[model samples]
Target: MLADVQKALDAFGEREINRVFFVGCGGSSSIMYASKYVMDRESTSLASDLYSSNEFIHRNPRQLGPESLVILCSHYGKTPETVEAASFAREKGALTVSLTFDPDAPLAKASEYVIIYEDGKQGGTFANEAPAIMLELVLGLLSSKEGNTKLDELLPSLENLRGIIDGEKAKSLAAAKAFAEAYQDDKVIYTMGSGANYGIAYWFSICLLMEMQWIHSHALHAGEYFHGPFEILDEQVPVIQLVGLDETRPLEERSLEFTQRYGKRIIVIDAKEFDLEGVAPSLRGYLAPLVMQAVLRQYAEELATARNHPLTTRRYMWKVAY
Candidate 1:
């Protein structure tokens, strides 16, 4: 899948492409947030933007044109708004690419370049695959433009990511079990993280807890917590902090310290605690969210089991027309 995406990217030529837009919905949109972060920090020549499907179609950016590349992601590829957004981009003469689990999905039909993955193969999480592919795509494009060998050197390490994630399954399962057991009775949960892991935090809060398990949850950035969210901290409220081994670790640490002092039920899922064997040290910061996604899948499953709620149970997601 990575090679295929790289090939599609190569066909565009570095100079021909002016901007890259990562557009999606829900968890898909959250992963694009991380992709935009990577492009902003690493890419020198290419510009990157992120937009939700509905917003992209209604409030389209003026920069979108024939020279622009729009990357649309949807696991099922059937999301009405995202499909409409892809059509809108195509109408504007922009190149459209889609990443989805189903190659024959509506999203794939709307795209010129499609990258498909087996549904259950990516550690039971769609969040893990898209970012890995998108990150490599951005890095590869930037490396070609800047002659940066570091990105080329780091690209191959992503192939070993699955093995690294599998090696930590036992540890992730244990942590999930403990977290589920402890937070089973909590009425509402608070999740926090910084940097790339912020997207994972948002995914857990919106996708897993609220949407799947029907539990009330809120996701907040560690840096933003002190501004307003910190006022909600108390001894009874449970907090889940995802700490990554990145430059933003200090921000999460500050939030952890303050949460620990006030909240009695603070659960920390720190990537520093895991042994991400075979992954390069220099790339750990970028891969931290992928690692957390693997761990959080286990946590989500365990939480569903502990609460006697199946993850498949939904009230309005697929049952009714929205």
Candidate 2:
């Protein structure tokens, strides 16, 4: 995967790249948020943005050109909008790189460079997962172009991620099961997080709770809670608050305190629960989302079982064309 990222970087060349755009849909789009966050915080000159694939096409930014790099993602490589966006980027003279689980997937074929990744089912290493690969790609760009030194700590943590994830999953099982039993009957659920872990909250709300389990769900940013979303808080709406060990921890902590005061049912999945023995202290923030996602997958599974609904069950996703 690193080799493929390097190939993309090489193709991009030393053209004084000024901007990056992350384009995708659904879960694919959610994973890009962390990469964008990393770029925003670390890079002084490079600008980064995230767009849904169709939006990327319709609102095509004028900055996209030979000096730009666009990264597109689709798990199966068949998402029409993302594939079209990749082609559109290439046509606009921006260097295009795509990530997918299939090398022969349409998204792969459409882009100039491709990086193949492993989903949870493949199970060899967390580094092969979409988030890790995307982080590496972004970190690679920052390291080479901006002289960012984060990768030194990040690479070692990624190497140990699979073990950390597995351990968290094992330890989180009982809490997940309890959450499922208590919240299975609720009509609506909410997820909230801040910083890098926000994407994990979004994925859980959209893909896992709502899409798979047929529950009404929404993802909330912890920082934005008091502004308006906190009004919706009550005993009935179960908010699954995801706490990351990042610099933004204070935001989540503040929201959690309010939720505890006003909300009756809350499930707090704090990344601090994981030991993270081998991961460096400085990189824990970036790794928190990945670890939380792995732990939350167990919760999602337990919720599905408690509701007597399989995670694979879907109503209109692939079955109906919009």
Q: Largest lDDT belongs to which candidate?
A: 2
Best by TM-score: 2
**Residue-level lDDT tens digits of model 2 in 143-163:** 878888887777878989999
With a 3 Å backbone cut-off (N, CA, C), the pairs that clash in candidate 2 are: none
Candidate 1 local Cα displacement, residue 104, angstroms? 1.0
How does each model score on lDDT?
0.82, 0.89
State candidate 2's TM-score. 0.97
**Which segments of model 1 are wrong by more than 4 Å?**
1-3, 120-128
Model 1 scores a TM of 0.93
